[model samples]
Target: MIDRSDGQDEVAGIAVRIIKEGDRIADIVKNLLAFARDWKEEQGPALIQDILADSLGLVEKQILKDGIRFKTYISPDLPEIKARSQHIQQVFLNILSNARHALNQRFPGFHENKVLEIRSEVVEIEGRRYIRTTFYDRGVGIPGNIRDRICDPFFSSKPRGEGTGLGLSISHGITKDHSGRLWFDSVEGEYTKVMVDLPTVE
Candidate 1:
């Protein structure tokens, strides 16, 4: 038997992650095909739990590898929402990726305080019921001066080779298309919380 510290485990971990990523991409493709089939009709309702579970599965490895603590609170009784599940999953992926990047930027080495928390529940506003998923990250938060421009097209804090600055803009549009809302709040060095609200199905 080989010793665990010989980097064999690290190599295996990378292989596992690659396999998982491939599986996730295949799943995403299936969902996109389903969405295309129903393009002429209303996309339909998808359980918030299912969507979150899928999204989390895709990113959990990356989060763990980076030494970031990830936590979630998803209400068991939350109602399903009317929307394309794939699009919502994409939104979650994008933000999670951004959070991971921010945390890595702020704490290059293992940081005991790095945490990402996700909460999901049903909420009521003006007599309307909605499902909301809020993601909070203790990272180098968005600067106040550029907070308003964060979602604008072609705007990014990442270096040129790392990003195209279209993630948030596309996410914003997808949320709007589903009759939902995507917004965030942050303090430069404290934390950032992004909330996605989508109307629940009756």
Candidate 2:
């Protein structure tokens, strides 16, 4: 009877493992489908602040794990913009994740004043109104020489087996598709700031 009981336990464990693997596969498929969705003409006016909150929520745990302090200065009454919510969320998540990774790489563990700052405002450039969002990280800044190539596909500063280097490239593409602009400024060994500018509905 003991042997039979042990066999049953083994089978149950295998079943449980299989279920977990299946769940993981399902999640991967869902993410892939979201990524492959066409963003060219999916223009819908969405609350930009709400999208930012949702994106930050998704990565809050990971941000906390590295002892990185996230600060936001979003404008309370920012106007709605035409954009795909999912794609905007993706853009923010990718930026936040990269900031966390960079902080970890520089400090390894928790350090005082390791901060990630996010800010948004309504700005005008050449007579056009835009909602400008900025993400700033006090971590390892990109080298000036290669800063221009940071958005190139498959370009990564991470070590082998760590990053595919496609995060920023995808982000750049998504921002462009929304008729927006994405760029960054960095002073090596100091800080890096990424900015996204999107047109607001009149």
Candidate 3:
């Protein structure tokens, strides 16, 4: 037979249920708050491909017509690392467009020495393969003082009204979320090399 004090157990059960409900409600509230703070734009992998294609199509005419020699060196065996293809495209388009802008600002004429080169290769570190992409341009390079802060949000070396400064910051965030790295090397009055590393699943 059950003890008469069994009411205590029933009350405890109800208290436990209340605690669980409270926890669930708290979790929901926290998730809603997070949603309000972040801009989630994770498109499908195919969409990223479309973004890449779109960037290539959009910039094909300008890069070649600018009279600045262009070159691309991609490793044939490098696999497409898991990434938002469109964001990747945006990153590249931004860099390429930036390259042109820097070159134009350097000289009025696109001489033989004025050129841009893009290269990609696979780098393996700690049993992980990464696609290392580099964008190099013989253009007026960024000043040392400002180059380090290029990825800082809302920090731009461009003239006022010319930049929002979010491009590189967004690109950096995307790379980081995909377990990658973004970096650059530049020397004023010489050249600049922007390197991006994306971890490959395989």
Candidate 4:
């Protein structure tokens, strides 16, 4: 039999856990609502770092639970870009989700090489400046045979019913709409690197 004080402590612990879980669920719902809404007409100056942080908050727990290491190196002075904040965040989330899937596919369990890295910096192209964000993952990468079709609508390597195949396609459209460029580099069974370049505010 436990002492009354011990029982009270246990109950308090359980109550705290329940409250924490409830708060987490609320946050997930909030993010989902934000993502599902139409932000097509709300373009403004947006900070890449803030968008990345919000996107990562949505999936960081799941990534950690999958036994994969996640890392980020965002430049301290990333310039603001003109964008629909929600749409840009969706792009970040999509890339992160793809990277997580690749890492999980390659390493079913915990492994040293199961890692994802995100880095951001400013780059120049044809005398113009752009913010370039990259996502690198050590996972089962794209095969040369189908590499060109990764962004094609309804093209997915995932098994039937597991993926709708429009993630990258939609992401590409969003980037292009924001005057940005999206591309990928990969070697089968090794790694995949995804890069997105969005023009900065003049």
Which residue pairs overlap in candidate 4's backbone?
none
TM-scores for every predicted model: 0.79, 0.81, 0.73, 0.81
CA lDDT, every model vs. true structure = 0.85, 0.86, 0.75, 0.89
Error of 3 at 29 (Å): 26
Ranking by TM-score: 2, 4, 1, 3
Query: Residue by residue across 1-202, what tens digits does model 4's lDDT show?
Result: 7569988999999999899767756765675566557654778999999999999999999999999787889999889999998898889988998899899999999999988999999999999999999999989999999999999977889875456677788799889989899999899999999999999999
Q: For model 3, what is the error of residue 52's alpha carbon versus the real structure, in angstroms, after optimal superposition?
A: 5.5
Question: Best lDDT goes to which candidate?
Answer: 4
Model 4 TM-score (2 dp): 0.81
Local error of candidate 1 at residue 20 (angstroms) = 27
| Tens digits of per-residue lDDT for model 2, 1-202 | 2469888999999999899767756765676577886544467988889999999888898789778998899888899999988888888988888888777877787788588999999999889899999999978988898898999987888875456677889899989988899999889888889999999998
Give the Å error, residue 21, model 2.
19
lDDT (Cα) of model 1: 0.85
lDDT of 3 at 124: 84
In candidate 4, stretches whose alpha carbon ends up further than 4 angstroms from where it belongs are 1-39
Clashes in candidate 4: how many?
0
Q: Which one wins by TM-score: 1 or 3?
A: 1
Give the C-alpha lDDT of model 4: 0.89
Please give the clash total of every predicted structure, in order.
0, 0, 2, 0
Query: Residue 197 error for model 1, in Å?
Result: 0.5
